[model samples]
Target chain A: MTSQSAAVLKKKSDRKKMGMKARENVYQGILWIFLIVLALTMILPFLYVVILSFTDSTAYQAGKLILWPEKWSTEAYQLILSGDGFMNALKSTLFITVIGTPLSVIINAGLAYMLSKPIPGKGFFNKYVMFTMLFSAGMVPNFMNIKQLGLIDNYFAMILPSLCGAWTIMVMRSFFQSLPVDLEEAAKIDGCGPLKIFARIVIPLSKPMLATMTLFAFVSYWNMYFNCVMYITSTAKQTLQVYVQKVVLSSTVSDVVDLSMDLATTVPQEVMRMAAVVVVVLPILIIYPFLQKYFQSGMMVGAVKG
Target chain B: MAKKKVKYKATNKTLRQQIYEFRWIYFLGIPGLIILLLMNYMPMRNLIMAFQDYNPHLGILKSPWVGLEHFQTLFQDDKFYNMLKNTLIISGLSLLTFPAPVILALIMNEVRNAKFKKFIQTSVYLPHFLSWAIVASLTFFLLSTEQGFVNKVAEMMGNEPTAYLFSSKWIYVIIVVQSLWKSVGWGSIVYLAAIAGIDQSLYEAAKMDGANRFQCMWKITLPSIMPTVMVMLILRMGTIISVDFEQVFLMNNAMVKQQLEVFEVYIYNNSIASGSTQYSYTTAIGIFKSVINTGLVLLTNWITNRKGYEGVM
Candidate 1:
């Protein structure tokens, strides 16, 4: 009688274990569905924009959401590229990004290197940089200062005002500090001066960090909006982001299209806006996958050290 | 002992010589120092404009000081109070959304499939790199009344289209939602790192004790990252007055400007866009914002420090 009761109890426990397994499976399935929905939310908007850029204007105006256009056209792309509004903005953006990024990296690297070493007055310099991080002069005064310097309507307004970033300097300084001190000591024994060691030894080993900083500076300069709005009054000198803002947000899209009437291809304003977005975002998207690996490490290092 | 003292004196002499030798290193830093002085410190000095009747021609040094005039005007102005209210509401909503990314990271951490995890991570992080202009355009395209995707979906569901962007009723919701969409994925990264730092043995032990997955997560993971969450929250509190200026500027229109006008927009309008030289008044508002931000940060730091978490000093 005791053996038979024990077998029945064992069967009951087995059923309970099965019930828990089923519940766990359901929970896991629900989580998967939620994550997939979230992933779609992130990806679909970008994909939709791309699709709309290529969709026929009439079809888009007909109120159909185009995930994949039945008929794709390159008219919007042609319109954007042919127009002086976008092309000029593109040129200005490229010029600033090319010139400003290297200039910023060099300045930041120099300051960061100085802060990394056991130099006299290092504490004072560190405090100076940190103070800037903590406080900022308001927009009016900064604008007034820039105007006094005669940088209004000039490319220097874009490049010079943002040449050195305290955060980037600190990141680079931490990176420098992390390197083995034995190498620098060895270089010192070989009679290499501070500048020589920095140029020849320290820099060579810091290519990854340099790339990360350069990419950061490039992106910041490429996406400069407010400064251009505040400083650059000329149509020819404005960056892509500001121009995109004008065309997309303001009532200037019709004006831009009218000014570009010489172009044979005519795309609707909506399509043209999406095309502009694609153009502005394409460069970053292309380079992102390659630089993404480096960026993750760089970000971790910066966050941990800072 | 006498010999050691003589050697220490010789080393002190070399330390001074080392300072002289590193002059070139300091030379490399000079340009940065000058730029910082011009760009950062100069404007800090110009904060005095908040106390003066600033004139462009008269310049900062020559401007006559009017103590408490701007502050008194700021306190008296209804528009200033409205802007402060709007700023607080929008930022308060943002503060409420701070834990969203933490929750997302926790959810993502539970997923066992590697491929699915990678896809979610890669897709979600894509938005962070996009400029606010692009985001604004996308938001408009997706939320606009006439031909927006959301309206289209609503129409399909037999509902009338809603003018979301133009309606003041929806502005706060739009701002907070857009901010979350843009940052939630990127913000999860640090929390994920913190979670990864947790010991696997704890999980194993919990499981051995017949604890369920949810129980293990609650009893272990969340507590382990509380300090990181606290630090991030404090830092975010420090910038509560400052909204994303570009996003606000892009989305703002005559229809919703009353609701969307925050401190940054107010400053821009009075000074740059308005073509008015109300520099002193705007500077006063700016100073007010900075003081509040600093106070909030210090207050949070003190509170967190008392709780024995590392504060972001």
Candidate 2:
């Protein structure tokens, strides 16, 4: 009787373990399914934009929406690229990104280095700086200030106003503070003056922060539609975002159809708009992955420690 | 005694050595100070425009002092109330749901497969890079009445599709969701980094004690990252009044303006809109907004600190 009871207990325990393992397997399956669906939802809209970019205008107007192009055509690209607006916007965006980013990195880095040091009255200076960041003069006052500076309608209106971003300086300062003090001390011991130490040792070591700040600056200046809309009344200086805005906000589908004489206009304004979206953002999406390898490390440096 | 002598020698360096020792420090400070003065501090004096009846022809100080007349005008305007209401609502929603990124990071941390995890992160973050103009356009494509994706899906499921943008009731939802879509991924980065920094040995110890993955996360991972979440939350509360002006301005139209007009837009439109450049009035509105924002930051910081979390203070 004792042997029989022991066998039954052993069997019961084995069955329970099997059941738990099976439940665990089911749970894992459910989790995977959820993640996959979430990822698909995230990617599908962007994919649809790309698909719409290649769809023919006539079918697009007819409301033939599909995950794939119904009839293929690059006429939208042709129209967008040939237009004077597109070329001018592209030039303006490129100019801003190329010029503005480096300037921000240098200025922010230099400021961060100085602020990172523990010196006399550093607290006062730091408070003065962070004050502008936390409490702004708001939009109108800043606009009036720009107007008073006689910066309107000039490229400097865009570049100069945003040159010294306080957030970037703060981020860089935090990053600089986190660096080991030994590096600076060792450089000092090597008969390195503060300038030489800063230029040769500090800047080289802070490359990741520099890269991250550069990316931040580039993205910001590229996406600057509000500033352009406010200060740039000139059509010649409109950026890509402004050009895309004009296209999207242009007269409705019927208005476009009425204005154009061409039969079955090869590209629908809707499709053209999607194509424009693809064109405008494609550079960053393409460039970011390459930059990501660098960006990941840079973000790690700022983020992980904090 | 020897160490004291060395310290004295260092302190008593010649004038040339003293200048050379501190020269790079000054070098770093000067250029940065100049740029800061130009870009930040200089424009700050224009806050004087708030006090005067700022007239372009008369110049800033040359204009007569209006004292609190502009502020009185601002408080009297009914639209001012609406702007303040809208600003508070939008910011409140953001603050309430700000922990979403932390939640998302926790979920991402659980995924075992590195490749799939990366794919999820990249897709989630892609929207952040899109400009507000682009996002607004995309929203129009997906949510518009005639040919939008959501409407089409609704039709297939046998429901009548409503125009999401035109309805005043739906405008706030649109703003909040768009904001979430754009920021959720980027926002997760800080928490994810915090999670990654958790000591591996803690998790191994949990496993040894027969703790499951869920238990391990609840006990170990969450607490480890709580400090990071608290810091982010404090920073968020400090700017709870300031909404992102670009997205709201770009997405709004006549039908939704009443519901969607935020403080930033209220200030920006007064100055930038054609035939509506009321300089003194806008400046006063700006000053009012700044004072309120500053007060809120300090108050929130004090409250959080008293409650025992490490806030911005």
Candidate 3:
């Protein structure tokens, strides 16, 4: 009788274990479904914009929306690209991003390298940068200072004011400090000076950090909006983002259609807006994958140390 | 002891001499220092405009002193109070979204499939790189009443199309949703890093004790990343007054202006966009924002220290 009862109890425990395994499977399945749905929410909007940009005007007006367009057309891209406004704005944006990013990286890296060394007044310099990070001069005062410098309505307005960012300097400084002092000492023992060590030894080893900083500066310059609106009063000088804003906000479908009627071709306002978005976003999207490898390590350095 | 005193004096002399030796290093920093002075410090000195009438013709130095008149005007303006209220409400709504990224990070952590996890991360990080202008345009395309994707979905469900941007009731909801969409994925990155740093031995032991995945996450992972979450929360709290100016500016329209005008927009409209400039009054408002921001930072830092978490400062 005791052996028979023990066998029954063992069977019951085995069944319970099977039940728990099934429950775990169900739990994981639910979690997967939830995450995929969340990711779809992120992705579908961009997909919609891309699909809508390709859809012909007639189909779009008929409300025939799908993941893929039934009748694809390049009319929207042609119209926007042909426009003087779009081309001019694109040129301005490219110029700023290309020129300004390198300039910023150089200045910030130099200042950071200086700060990282155990030089005289290093503590004072560190405090100076930190204070700017914590406090700001407010919008009006900064605007006033820019005006006083006669940078209003100038391209230099975009580049000059943003040259030295305290946060970027801090990040670069931390990265510099993380390097081995022995390497620098060795370079100095071999008759290398400060500038020589910085140019040859320091820079070559700091490529990943410099690349990340450069990417950040590039992105910010490309996305310049508020500064352009405040500083560049001329329509010809406005960057792509500001111009896109003007187009998206000020124009309607009927207005675009009427304008297009004169040119013997019809461009829907929706399609034009989507095309503008693609144009503004395309450069970043193209370059992102190349620079992505540095992002994880770069962010680690910034977050862990800073 | 006498010999040690001489050595200390020798070191003091070397320190001063070192400054002269490293003069070139200081020169390397000079350009950046000058730029900071021109851009950051100069503006701070221009905060004196807050107390003056600040006429462009008279210049900053010659502008008549208004004393507390700008402050008095700010205190009495009905629009100022309304804008303040709206700013607080918007900021409060955004603060509610602070945990979204943390939750997302935790969810991502649970996925055992490495490839799928990476795909989701890459896809989600796409939005962070898009400009606010593009985001606003996308929002309009997806939410507009006439032919928006959302409206089409609603129509298929036998519901009337909703024009979200035009409705005052829906503007804040739209703003909050847009902010979440833009930031959640990018923000998760830091938390994911923190989670990655957790000891794998703890998870192994949890499994030894028969803890399920959810149980392991709750009992082990969440508690492990609590300090990171607290630090991020404190930093966010410090900027409670400042909304994303570009997002607010681009999303705002005449119809939604009443509900959407935060301090940033208010400052722009009064001082920059308006035909008549109220430089002093606007400067006063800016000062008030700075003070409140600094105070909040100190307050949160003090509270965090009291709670035994590391303070951000």
Candidate 4:
């Protein structure tokens, strides 16, 4: 039971390790290399966008892979910003994200909280929501309905149509149900009404989940494309995504002649596209690391053991 | 906000009392229900447009009823079949690659070094946050005939520059790769969570039984996460008829447009694109697709349940 037996056991396992260690090393080594390469592939496209955006026209004109620039330049940014359409798009995108996110979170939280309660008709309510999750009306009918609501060309067309979805509500309902009921029980005993208990105990206690939902709503609103396209017809109401798509995918730029010979010469289309890509994604990239845990936690809810 | 509400005194409340007690909660749910009614249910009601001659001035209700005419057009149209085929192929290819993240997650679970694992996770997850617009731009930069990074590198290595952007040959492959790159990391989170929820004791027991690392993973980790894998598979299969229009549309060049005319893109083109608004026909097309998707979901859910796992539905 003491040092002598321990020594024998250690030696026995040590010998086994000696044989298996080499194979394990190879396995582990290959795993690491495969993962490292996979990670780099994910990262490099974004890096490539950022790098090419900043690369001076000279390096770009070299017809070589521009990994690093001899001289970093902001001409692309200057040119993209110089366009009123791009600026308008950015402003509207920002407007949608700001307005949509808070409204979305509150709606989701309220509906989810009510679902979490032992309210009458709750089961029917759940099924009703779940039905929406399973089958959505196709875009045309949905567009017609939105148009009938007088949301066409309206910002609410973008915001209201997709403000709260059933899948999100279900996920959030689970979150609410997972919250400790003891606080509510105590609040009830102290003669605190349901609203008071929810406003005080539930809201404060569920900050992490709320934060995660907030970020998700924010991201969805920020990345919104389908709604923006279907609902908002006017260029003035178009979003960053629409703007970026026009800049990035449409090779001819629609009216290249209007680009002006001087501007085209100074800042080529490719570089401008790269810069637009960066501008569109910069906020997410900056906040991503800080909010990464929230994302994981939200998904892994009720799954984590330790 | 209601200051005059009295404290509950009843030990066993009647239905009326219970309903009255929950009134405020019901009040909280009003705005959401209204939104759902307007945004979701109203659209569903307007799905009647698929059977009618939808004239905007007439509105959906007053529009002339043309039962099954739009549906007939949808089925008879060659473009409809083409769109359906493209949608199926793209979604099917993507669904086949769904397990990529599961494999990645398993490999990730094997890494002993926490820091290195964190680095990999962080790096991989970033791509998911990128909007389709950025990915499309990135694709253009990679595939551009002359100044593209890939072509430039190919030229530097004395290889021929392939017409990646200007050709339809690689459109499907391009879509698959783009989806994989964007989703694999985010998709793996669920599998990783499943792996995390596996009993650690099972692994230790496997180790004690002289099972090697691969043996342990195969016998223990793999079997443990099967239910989760099944659930995910069923869920994915349900939506296999629908493809992401944003990604396909944004990535579409004239070269690839014919090859990549998915249902959503077709709808967008006919109903919402500049100068076209064939609402009745497009509505019929959408209804047909959604019906197929919904049927697939129910069918897959029942199959999964028959196999003894809890159904995703």
Sorted on DockQ, best first, the list reads 4, 3, 1, 2
DockQ of every predicted complex: 0.54, 0.49, 0.55, 0.56
Per-residue accuracy of model 2 over B176-260 as CA lDDT, tens digit each: 9888888877788777877878999999999899898899889999999887777677768777778888988998789988988
Ten contiguous residues minimizing lDDT sum, candidate 4 chain A: A297-306
Candidate 4 per-residue lDDT, tens place, B1-313, comes to 1221222233366557878989889877778888888888888887888888877777777989999998888788999889988988999999989889889988999998888998898998888777887788788888888778899999999999988876888889989999999988888887787788788999888888888888888888889888888778877877788887889987776778889999888788888774435888888888898889888978987877888776322
What are the lDDT figures for the candidates, one per model?
0.82, 0.77, 0.82, 0.81
Taking chain B only, the TM-score of every model is 0.89, 0.87, 0.91, 0.90
User: Of models 2 and 3, which has the larger DockQ?
Assistant: 3
lDDT of candidate 1 over A1-306, digit per residue (tens): 999999999999999999998998898899999988998988888888888889776555545555677778988887788788888898899989999999899888999999998776687899898777777787887887788788889998888878987888888898899999999899999999888999998999999889877877887898898899898989998999988777776554656533466543345677788888888999988877766676346454354324
Each candidate's TM vs. the true structure?
0.91, 0.89, 0.92, 0.91
The digit string of per-residue lDDT tens for model 2 on A219-292 reads 88888798898888888898889888877777653232222334324566777778778888888787677556
Clashes of 3: 0
Error of 2 at B179 (Å): 0.9
Model 3, position B145, has a per-residue lDDT of: 82
Query: Residue A115 error for model 2, in Å?
Result: 1.9
- lDDT by residue for model 1 (B128-212), tens: 7788888888898899886688998888888999999999999889988888899888888878877888999999999999999
RMSD of each: 3.6, 4.2, 3.5, 4.6
Query: Measured with DockQ on alpha carbons, how good is candidate 4?
Result: 0.56
1 against 4, candidate with superior DockQ: 4
Candidate 1 residue spans exceeding 4 A from truth: A1-25, A62-65, A250-254, A257-266, A295-298, A301-306, B1-10, B14-16, B156-158, B299-308, B311-313
Poorest 10 consecutive residues of model 3 chain B by lDDT? B1-10
